[model samples]
Target: MLEQLSSVFFDEANELLDNLESQLLTLGDNPNDSETIAAVFRAMHTIKGSAAMFGFTDISSFTHEAESAMDQVRNGVIPVTGELIDLLLKARDHIRNLLDAGAEVPENYKQVSEQLIIAFKIYVSKNGGNASLNQPVKKDVPKIKKEDKLSFSWRIKFRPSKNIMKNGTRPELLIKELTEMGTATVVPFYHALAPLSEIDSELCYFSWDVILTTGKSENDIKDVFIFLDDESKVEIEKIDLLPGENNRIGEILVDRKDVSREELDKILKEHRQLGVILVDKNMVSEEQVQSALAEQQHLKSLTPGGQVATPQSPASTQTLRISSAKLDQLVDLVGELVTFNARLEQEAQEKNIAVFKSLSEQCGRVVVLMRDVSMGLRMVPVSTLFSRFRRTVHDLAAQLGKHIEMATVGAETELDKTVIEKLNDPLLHLVRNSVDHGIEMPEDRVAAGKTSVGTVTLSAKHAGAFIMITVKDDGKGLDRDVIRAKGIQRGLISENDNLSDNEIYNLIFQPGFSTAKSVTSISGRGVGLDVVKKDISTLSGTVSIETEKGMGTTFILKIPLTLAIIDGMLVTIDNAKYVVPLNAISECIAYSMPAEEKGQRFVTTTNHGKPLNCINLREFFNFGKEPPAKQEILSVYDGDEVYGLVVDKILGSQQTVIKPLGPLYGNCVGINSSSILGDGSVALILDVYQLTGLIKNSSKKAS
Candidate 1:
């Protein structure tokens, strides 16, 4: 159980670290951004609490110091500074290292942790921002006007996580912690407990309703719940009672939201004590009425004869955190359902039964809809990727002594989680390239008549079934001559090869290719762009560049939205089936390329216009059988290049659940994955980019 919870803790810890990095970068820019500041504090606080709970004492102790500094920063006792931000950022990385290192942290790492702890401690030590090793946490207490220091009354509903006891949390410790503030009456609710045989010793079945009279504000009370996870229910409300003998029970029940106002009014019509009526009518649980009565009695004592209930509002919709592994399992099940539906259609066709055919069609629609929803569950906003690179840009800028900022557009564009995961390395490389090489330094930028701060824009948007992600920078663009020289020096291309400017730029992706004058800490070693190419290609994607000599460069990646499924246009070549992504095809024509107008690897229309790079599927794959009398031409595109894919015949569209061809066909060109046909035969999914490689550059396109 500890092992399982530790896994969840690490996952959550990583997410919090990502959030922390992003928030810290934001706070670095806008020092007075209170919300971001508080977010950093909350993240640190949660990590500290969770780490302490999980027995990661070193991590808990280390993060506590950072949290203390942040708390003082939160209280406005300490100011945000670049040095402080730098310290916190280092601390964040240390926490991540600790999490990654697992149960044990090394002695040297402990020293590093202590170093950061001291730095955070000293950074906030000035102006009583917690200089001491044992400074008590100061709550944001409200000043009471009454003679009694404990002038505020609060109702706290706390339900510990079911596994809290298993995790070794003591409820008495919590209650004891709470009593430090002032008076707290904790009424334990055991109504949720089952009979002895049914109860699990490891599980916690208790909740509490605490009526506390204190001068502390809501924030102060919230601090007591640092032990709880986000899913735990902890509602804190302040009581504003008035002095009166006629303090209404029905009002208290309604305000507590244990009973609706309508139910209270309706129950009052019977007037046999509102609590008893509510419990007997089953308007609320007996425990709820008793808790309301507890509040009623507590408030009456405060006001000498009255109890006032604070108004409660509906809570936000809850979100469940299911691991991606479960989502993948669901999608795999959906894929099976799709295959099963296809089998139904095939059986219906073979029998030529009208009823079965109708049923198959209905089931097919349902499967397609269900498939869409299941896949949609895996589609997350690209902002998750975009926000992550902000730190990359921030750190690189500081390292390189450049003024750089990130701008994003269409961040809400969604893509499959698998694609997004694979995209991380490629995106990281591109973003680093943009910062290291693409974005010019401040002085150089000013001299070049651009802004002092270079901007790297990361944007993503949907284009049909593909997602187009652009990493653009406002900096000195690629020097084609330098790239050409590097390509020649590396033997990737000869000097007399006469490469186009675009081709010259693409040579940067060649292994061992570099335009850097010398090796540096970042990109000068000549290995980043090739990774971008290799990764994007594995996803059956393509990359292209757009640049102007003095302006900037943009690396555009066009990748399929999902690897699991596609609305493919199935085609036939030599009686063998293939699936072309329907979204990739512009149109299909029923005319062959005029033999006389055909170039080496391209074909021209009847009008004999510019040649379109064409790949004859039959000839490209060298199929045994010949094509039919008539052939079809699929006008498709890769990036901005228009191309034609020639096929024997179009077999219409299919809901293709793309399956990997496995290692045997891993090296196969023009085919990346396969889909199961209705009759249970495998149809290869055509990769347009790979097929484009089969088509040599045409004279018409070059000119």
Candidate 2:
């Protein structure tokens, strides 16, 4: 166990570092949270111990200072302070760099470690120092236990993850590590092994069953597989009975899951070989019987043991950690299945077969259920993404000499993991903007009759099939006149242009559009908000601003829950088909083409006494044929107001698995994506927000 595998150690060490950072951030939130304080100590201690065991001497040596400092916090020798958190955060990052870049010590890393060591010593001296850290800086050598003189028997089952080989592990190395501990009888299981032609060299499908008689403790054996804890399954049973003890064959067979207890009992009553009887009864195969026999023989080889071992306990786990890459692949396969199910249903209707139709209906129902479950798998809580900003807010507030706190609401709101990843930059930009621009200086805030401590609130709530993420700041709002002047100065607008207040607020999203006289790191580069607009646009989401003259400003982002698939209202104009997102639609109403709209891009009509701006789909895209005198108006809400999207006909609703148009048509106005219909026709998905906003603005400016 003391001889460590490099790949395994690095994987686990990096994870510990990430956990260490998160726990430290939580401590920053509630300095008096004793639970968090203890957790931080544990993480630091584990990292230091594991690093020493794995021969990461540099990490172990540097981490010793951090560990002792945290020990001081745990023992109530010192209180947690912002300075302490900052020092530890820097230490965490430094250790991560060491792990990432390997043994090559960069100049900056050396400087950081030296500085951090000095600070850790300060904290240590403040608590009168710890004697334990006085030990020599070297890899920890496990001391021989008293049990090293006493022999015991163990049965170990090592079922490694199939993708273990991808981590550069040689399976034989594990066996070697175990054999070094004692006399081992190893049997390889190739049940999952593929044929040579179909074999994947990158994947490991082999597993091992070992019966070892040794003086080593069970903990030593467990430590050998500690790095594989999440990626592999290991079961070690202390079965120290001597040869010919208590129907060991049946027990071995049962333990291997090759035979059930009831089946074994029934066969044992017949007084024949349990394995043979089971194979005769067609219960387990001859191969399984052989595997069980090997295990039984290995147990017999345990020379007249010292003490009998109790039965192994059942394993219990509440949760499992999985790779995001695997989840993405699973979702891709499910998307294909969903499309195939639609094709099956369509074929059934076309062929007019009753039995086939029934089968298709059942399959369709199952696929729908699977679609829901698969999509749900990607729905991670927003809290994980939000929690990361605590340190950023803390450091930025300190840097700017401002007193601010980031308050989060609806942190439990869920969204697609992919969307959340893309959303990070946009949110980061908005937050930085709020801190640097929206929030005023302490004196200025008091002059404005507001609290000195500014608050930036991040909130999310479900809006139909969409989720609205709002970032609001309780500080000086966007000045309408200042923005207007800036817009005109930057040639983003004209003095002659009669724009609404909302339109003026949106001027910030334009590239290189800023009202600031100078730029800083937080904001005023003029690129952050522009990048926000473009990135959100790619996800088929929209951003809007709500600002009062003296009140604080709020930036609201309305995004679809999952971008992979959507419930769409399929509509057709002449020979072309288009899908309008169901979430954007309010209601569909029949409309007669007016004589005044003969050559117009949009027709202003009335709905419930409100002027509804309607866009004619056929005329806008210009198809081969003319639209019917009677057209259909789909009321589309673009987060601001409801506009009418006039189409030829409405063809109900269906699940649309979105396929991106890629860069070729990325900027092709209005069309967000395309989907394959059940009939194998490609239907374009309309960007309701973009279509309404782009065309509405164009129509207004034209008039």
Candidate 3:
């Protein structure tokens, strides 16, 4: 199959740009780290090279300028500084815009590009020496002359590190790129690998003996190992040629002067370094160095731009360049499989045959495996989402003139690609808000007996089946009095009404709410935090805040692992059916009969708890029909506490594919999204958090 290589380039370029922006911002704070300097250099290098391949000529050209600057930092020719970092950030954004232009040249983008170049050159002039910031014009990259080329033949042996794949390089892709360089033949060397029982999937154990004949110099071949030089073992040597040079490897080697008579005799006697014998004896000239370098770079580019040496595993996997559409199709197939498995199992039980029943059980196992494989395809690390916030926090902190440090944990946590995509904007807003509004100024922090450097921690971890992503900041915590006063002024609450701390903190998420004494460009727009809450809740997730008077504040978001599918607890209320995410259900118990007080009945106690207020399903719906004498109360937890919701009956569990509620139901409260049952019934997925909010609001109004 003809592989589309540019997609990988785009994906990688984007990731590098994100890393570049984040690291540059961080370097602005601490510019002395040699490690971070190298990181910035690598990110720029990858973006520049990949952008070239994807036909992002302007991005490649523009990013080359930044890469040139970063390369100087990497080599210690220039010192990292705040001014340098700021200029690099502007450069990063411009490169991003260029990449975003994708195969088209957008009008006025050139002007933006020129502006960025001027800013970068100015910073270079200021922070860099007068020996000429823009004074040293970049030299054009040298290229080989194909027609005048002298081809050489050699046997190259390569064994990559175990983590080459993890580093985003596939040996298959490397091999393919190598083949593109010249006439090549590959012989896979699988002799040294351990048995399957002792293998590690992360390791690359196999090696290859390649016979390649290319007009490119040996240096050209060696350059291919640049990024992998630290991580793998590679050896290339010229060999003697046979009579028919064009027809066979042996003949080609003889023509290249790789295997001398002495070397061949030594091979007959005892083998010696073939390339050494040929080159040291002046058989190959200084000109060969150029081709060798080109070939080497060509080879190195096939691997990841950066890697480190590691052990190999017996199970070497191959990477296929599959289109994302194929993955979507696979996921759809798996979804259908799950539905059919449910149907088959249901039918088998009716047949009551042991043989068919056993087959159904086996099919169930296969279905589970297929579902996992499909889900894995959609599982992208949350690290991308988390890494993005680093830049946001850094830029906003600098803008707001706060000394805040961001610490992230559990970044390796995985979530659905769709979830990650939708989560980025909301997460960005939250981190920005924390950096601007949550963290106190360095002087204020010191006065409060706290460290001068405040902290914003972005963390993700699995709590049961749900992923909890929390943004916690150490600053002057939320002031309840300020929020309460604002609420009264806005008529969201009565002046004398009593409210809990949680309620007061949550008011900040109300639309058109702001407690800032004076609005600033960075925040206090009165629209950001509320949008964050709405966006999160739209994912069937819950957002809550915790704060201490002088310590800090935390905004915790609880989201499901995937939105495409979920395990839902089916229930009925009146004539309407509803689905509650099984992950949120703490338990379900029979609601005890209760006495009526003012035309309302409440469940006093069911499971060793105090009298908990519950609404009769029929009465809550105002169905005008008598409520079911018996009720099943589902206890749902919203990350903080649990509440029982009364329903008519539990109709078992289902795999529900979430469907967004259309604009017509835009104002519907308590219903987060709708999903389709296998039986073609539309089940309204209840937002337990919203439902609890409804109960709280109703009780407050009554009191």
Candidate 4:
């Protein structure tokens, strides 16, 4: 149990650290934002508290020092500076290392931690003293009444729930905290205790009535019990003391002439509350005093902090943290269910029974809904992946002496968590390339009629069934002449080859192709773009580049929302079945041989009243026999280029559960993965992007 708890704490701490880094980066931009400062301080404080609870002593101790430093910033003693944020960010990273290492202090980390501590001490000394680290600065408490200089007194009745101790709360610790404010006289009541024979040793039956005399406001007292739930009945009532003040219920009744002073005194001598006495003696009705008491409690519950102590509503939704492995398993099962449902629907249609058809249709709807919900469960906002780039951009800009500003749009666009994880490295490489190669120095940018600070905009939007993520930089775009020259020098393209600007820009993704003049730590290795292309291709995604000579460059990545299942257009060539992603299909046209295009692999057809060039899939996949006399041309769009994929027959669309092809055929060209059809046969899922590349290469070879 302890190990499990520690693991949970470690996970939560990592998340908090990520949040801390993000907030600190934001604070660097908006230095004077008090809310961000407070948030940073709170995150540190939470990590420290949880670390201590989980027995991570090293982390707890190290974080306390950083938390104290953040406290100074929070209290406005030290203004937020880039140097300070840098230190805090390093501290955050060190704390993560500590958590990762399970509180074991590695030697290298110890040296770094000591250096950071010394730096913090120097900053503290320069400010004033180390007093802030040792003690909290007390805020001046507002006086309720200036004329009345007497200390306020509160009568607190705390009746703890029987299972309060089960949650690891110590009542004595709370009482001790109360005593720290001022004089506190706690009187325990044993009236609710059961007989010894019937007692449960684990349960708490004691209640406390305390008279606390202090200068602190009621909020100060409430803060002590903030962790307690609504089941713990706590009531705080102020005892008024003034010359003409009717301080007690009986006094108020007598002052209102509802009770005689003799009756009040006689009932009070019986040692009961004045309200109960008045009600029993018929001086005032029960409802009247009850209403007054309720109003008094309501007023007292409104603390000086301006927050009411209302019971937490249980109707609020709660979230449980489950392992990602479990979620992946569930998604796989859902995929299987979808595949099975497809087979069932096929069977129902073949049988042509009315009842079976009706049931199958209804079941199909439910299965589709279930598949959507299950996939949605794995769909998390891309912002979680995007936020990590802020630190990257900040550090890289500073190191390269470039002024760059990053702006993100559609960060709330959601994708499968698995896809986001795989995308991180590719996105990082793109951003790095933009900063290092695309973005010019401040002086150069200014001379080029651009803002001194280059802007890199990362945006995402849903394009059909795919999410289009684009990383664009308003800096020096890819120089087509330079890229073409490099391509020729690298023997990637012939000097006489005719390529468009887009095509020239894409040559950067060719293996060992780079236009960088020299190798630096940042880029110029010519490895990142190729790896990005390969990774995205493996994810069944496509990448395209758009560039202008002087303005900027944009790399757009089109990826599916999920990889488990897809709506695919099942087609057949010869006897083999193939599945083409529906998202890639534009339209289908009848194959016609133009007289001038005889023996040509691509035919010019009109789509939306414009000429379109389509690739014949049957010939591309090498269907050894003669082409069918009447074949359908499936026009598919790869980026802005529309091409035709000729098929012997279009078998409509079906939900395709993508199953990975083993390593034996891993290098198979133009086939991304395999999917199972309703008849228990396999269909090759075409890699449209790779197929386009193949066609381009084949055409180049023929030329």
Candidate 5:
């Protein structure tokens, strides 16, 4: 149980730290934003309290000092500064380290913690008077006995159900929490206990009456019992203690006619409290008296500086944090269900039975809805991925002595969680490259008739079934002469080879290709871009670059929204089936054999009043059979050029679950993965991007 709680705390702590980093970054941008400062302080405070609860003393202690510094900022004692933000950022990172390491302290982490604490204390002292470096500055905690007009006494009756112990609730813990809020005098009642012969060991028979005096709001007290259910009986009332105050409890009871004025007067004449006398005489049960007290408390709490505490409403929707492994399993199951639905639909169509067809169609609709909803559950906003880059840009700009601002747009664009996770490294590489190589220095920018502050924009948008993410920078763009020369020197291209600007710009992604004149610790090694290309390709995504001579460079990544399943156009070639991603297919046109001329087999067609280049897949795959008399050309746009894939026949469309190709076929080009058809036969899902590149390479070799 303790381990489980510690794990939960670790996860919560990490999320809090991520939010802390983001808040600190915002604070750095707008130093005078009080709301952001308060948010930062609250995050730290929550982490500290939760850490202490989970026995993570190291984290708790470190966060306490950080929280104290933030508290100073919150209270207007210390003005926000870049140095303070940097310190807090480091503190957040240290807290994450502690969480990751658990009970074992990482080497030198203690030293770092001590240094940060000293820095925090020094900042606080520099702003004002001498501040203690050893002890954290404590905020004034509200007390029960403070001579404030808002101070009031609460009478609480807490009665646990007979089987409360069976529900794993420790009543003592609740009592202890209440005592911590103020001065609490608890009196236990054992009147409900049965005789020994009839007693149940697992049952709880005792109840308590507590008198609490506190200036704190009633919500504070009720929060202690927030976990209790309807089975527990709890009543709270404010007891009036002012001199000359009327006996409102008795007056209320008499007014409500629960007890008549004559009975109240008779009880009062017996020299006893009205409530006790009524309860003892059975004029009102204990519950009724408690109810009257509650009403009195509610009315009294309505006065100035009084808080009326209402029972917490249950959440209409609750979020359960399921493990990613579980979600992956669910997606896999859903994929299988989708495949089975396709088979059922095919069988129904083949049988031509009206009832079966109707049932199958309805089931198909339900399956489609389920697939969409389940996939949506795995979709999260890209902002979660975008926010991390702010810190990266900040640190990189500072280290490189440059002025760069990173602006993100369309962060709310949603993508599959798996895709976002896989895209992180590639995106990080692109952003870092933009900062290190693409963005020019401040002086250079000014000399070039531009603002000193360069801007790196990261934007994402939905494009049909794909998401297009672009990383652009307003800095020195790609130099055509330098890239051409590098290409020639690296043996990647001939010196006289005429290439479009797009093709030349793409040479940067070549392995071990760097245009940087000097090496730096950050980037001149020329290793990241190639890896970025490879990673993106592994996800069946495409990366393209657009640049000008002096304006800027933009790299756009086109990625499918999800990798689990895809809408594909299944095609047949030489009795074998293949699937083409529908998003990649531009259009399909009827193909007829062109007159053979000098061994040239390509055909040209008109699309949107422009010429389109077409390639027959049968010839490319070398199917070793005569071309089918009837065939179709599937046109696809590959960023720079449009090419056609001629197939033996079009096999209509399919919703396919992609099963990865094994390592034995890892060397295979054009085909990325295989999918199961409705007939239980496998069809290779074509990687159009790879095929286009291969086609280009093959054409070059032939020429």
Candidate 6:
């Protein structure tokens, strides 16, 4: 239970931090957005409470100070300035790290915390003095006024719905809330009870009563019961005001018969401004002002209204905190299920019994569903990955002394959880490359007829069964001369090679290829693009580049939807079967023996007169002698391109759960992973990227 509570605290803390980051970014652009400030305050307050409960005293204290700072902004006591926001953003990161590291913080962190707290205090004090004039001057109590005055007392009762207590509410807590309003005594009303044998522990059966001498009115007391009113009963009545009560505005107004409509209207207008205008204008006496203030307090308790609920901004939509162990467990279960289903199918085929056959078919469907659910559980939206870039752009642009604005789109697109995990590093490299190399300085953009704020767009979308992720920038596009020169200098390309523009652009991914004069910590060391290419390709994905001088450049990535399972076509090679993802197989045709025929167009030929790649499993894998008869050609196409992979037989298609080969064959070629055959044999899942690479190379040799 303690562990779960801690987990909940950290989870909520992380979420609050995300909200804080996003709101801070917006506040940078629109500082007057009070709603955003309120949202930031709420997130901080939630973090403070959760942290306190989880025993992170430092986090609770730090966030309490931060929340107080934000509350000042919300209440119009302070402005949301860029410098303050930057400090707060740094503070958020510090808090996030503290929560993640738990209670065992290093001594070095103490200085940073103290410095942040000092800054927060400075911020609060700077604007704290200019606060609303009517805000209560904290001081000792004064003696009561008698005759020319008025006094009133209020009795209040409250009963909360059972669910309130179940949801972590306590009647004592509510009574304590009333006490905070003014001097009041709490009395427990504990009569509603059931026999022990019939009682439900989760059910709440409690109520409360309170009497108070306060400057606030009856409405103020009733407001405390707003959330509980629907499920509980609440009663409030005015009594004779005590001696001190005559000085209370609420009491004085009631006694003077000034509780009329006209005065109420005047007080409500100046309510938020501290009611000084009403008092100064003599439209409402100080005692009446006190009661009106209490009425406002009651309204505040009802729903805590005053600001709009900010949109479920981009940052919150993308991330989920999950245990890596749980993910591994799920993968293991899916793998076992796939293996078992395969064995069952094999048994049913061998037995040729009606019951066994039906059971095998049912098992196949269940296996498919299981694989899908497991994979679905691992799917995460791309937005979570995108949010981190905001800080990166801000910091890097500042460091480089350049002005750039990063834009994002299609962040809601989803990718496999494992894939997203693997993608972060490569995406980071790409973004850094874009900012450091792709985009230009503010003056340069202006010289190039572009906006001073150069734009770097990071986006993702689904195209067919592939996820197309892109990183584009509208700065100075790839410089052809510089790239060609760098290629020659790095031995990536020869000056006499007559490389096309696309081929030249591809040279950027070559090892040790860079055009920067000096290497910096951020990006220009020439160690990133090559590694990024390798990482992306390892996932059976391809990265392509497009550029136009002075226009911009875009890097497009085409990757499979998920790595775990796919609808695949079973094909035979030398009587050894393999599974090809169905999404990649454009069509299958009968063997016209085109390769053996003369002067005829084959499927292994492209419209550009270049022969398409053909991978003959018999020759490539050396799977013994081929069968006498030629099998059909399974023409798999990715976009407009096609490949003819010749096999011995076409074995139909089925939904197959992809299982990774253990470390023994981690670097194996031709195959990406293995899947379980319905009959229980291990079927190799072909790596389309590797297979196509080999076929294309072989075609180049033959040509």
Q: Estimate each model's TM-score.
A: 0.73, 0.68, 0.66, 0.72, 0.72, 0.69
Candidate 6 whole-model C-alpha lDDT, 0 to 1: 0.72
Decreasing TM-score order of the candidates: 1, 4, 5, 6, 2, 3
Ranking by lDDT: 1, 5, 2, 4, 6, 3
Q: Residues 1-703, candidate 5: write the lDDT tens digits.
A: 8888777877877888888889999999999997899789889989999988878888889888888778777767678988988888888888888888888887699888998888888888988833674466666642222244365667677998887889888887888888777656566678788999999989888887676767778888888888886799998777654312344788867744689888888788888787888888899877667766754555443433343333334762466777788888888998998899889988998999999999998987887787888888899999999998999999999999999898999999999999999999999999999999888999999999999998989999876557889999987888988988999998999978889777888899999999888888888788889998998877778898888767898999988789898778989988899999888788888877664611234555666788655566776677766786677878876655677777778978767898988878766777878999888989998877766766566566566
Native-vs-model 3 lDDT? 0.72
- lDDT for model 5: 0.81
Question: lDDT of candidate 1?
Answer: 0.81
List CA RMSD, all candidates. Answer: 15.1, 17.2, 12.7, 14.8, 15.5, 16.2
Model 3 off-target regions past 4 Å?
1-8, 50-57, 102-329, 340-363, 494-498, 571-578, 585-637, 642-651, 663-671, 690-703
User: lDDT (CA) for every model shown?
Assistant: 0.81, 0.80, 0.72, 0.79, 0.81, 0.72
lDDT of 6 by residue, 457-529 (tens): 9999876557888999887789988999988887777879987687788888988777888877885678888
For residues 1-703, what per-residue lDDT tens digits would candidate 3 score against the true structure?
A: 1145666776667767777777777687678886788788778778877777666788878777777767656645567877777778888877777777777868699888777777666655665633233333343432233354655556677888777777876787777767778767676766568898999887777776576766678888887776773687888887443312233322233444544555555543434554444456676543342333333433332212112213245453555556677877788777777767767777788889999999998997887777777888899888888877777777787888888788988989999887898898788878887787788889999999999998999899875446899999988889889889999998989988888888778888889898777888866668788888888866778788888878888989988788666678889977778888898887888864554632353333446655454555455556666567776888777565566777888888866667789778856766778876555667798877667656655666667
RMSD of 2: 17.2
Candidate closer to the true structure by TM-score (higher is better), 1 or 3: 1
Per-residue lDDT tens digits for candidate 1, residues 273-331, read: 76777777777888887787777676665543222333334442355678999999999
TM-score attained by model 2: 0.68
Error of 6 at 221 (Å): 30
Write the residue-wise lDDT of candidate 4 on 1-703 in tens digits.
9888888898888989899989999999999997899789889899989988988877887788788887767655666888888889889988988877875678887788778877877787677646446454443553233443345666676888888888887776887888777656566666669999999977788877565666778887898899986689887766443322224656544544557788777787888787877777677777556544533443344444322435446763466788999999998998898788888989999999999999988998898888888888999999998899988999899999998888999999999999999999999989998998899999998899888999888999876557889999998889888888999998889989988676888899998877778888887888899988988877778888888777999999988778888889998989999998898888877775555754456555676788655566766676667767777877777664666776788989878888988878877877879998777888998887667665555555556
lDDT of 2 by residue, 223-292 (tens): 8886773678898987644543544777777766667788778788898766677878888877666666
Taking all chains together, the TM-score of candidate 6 against the true structure is 0.69
lDDT of 2: 0.80
Where does model 2 exceed 4 Å of error? 1-22, 103-107, 127-318, 586-614, 624-626, 629-644, 692-703
Best by TM-score: 1
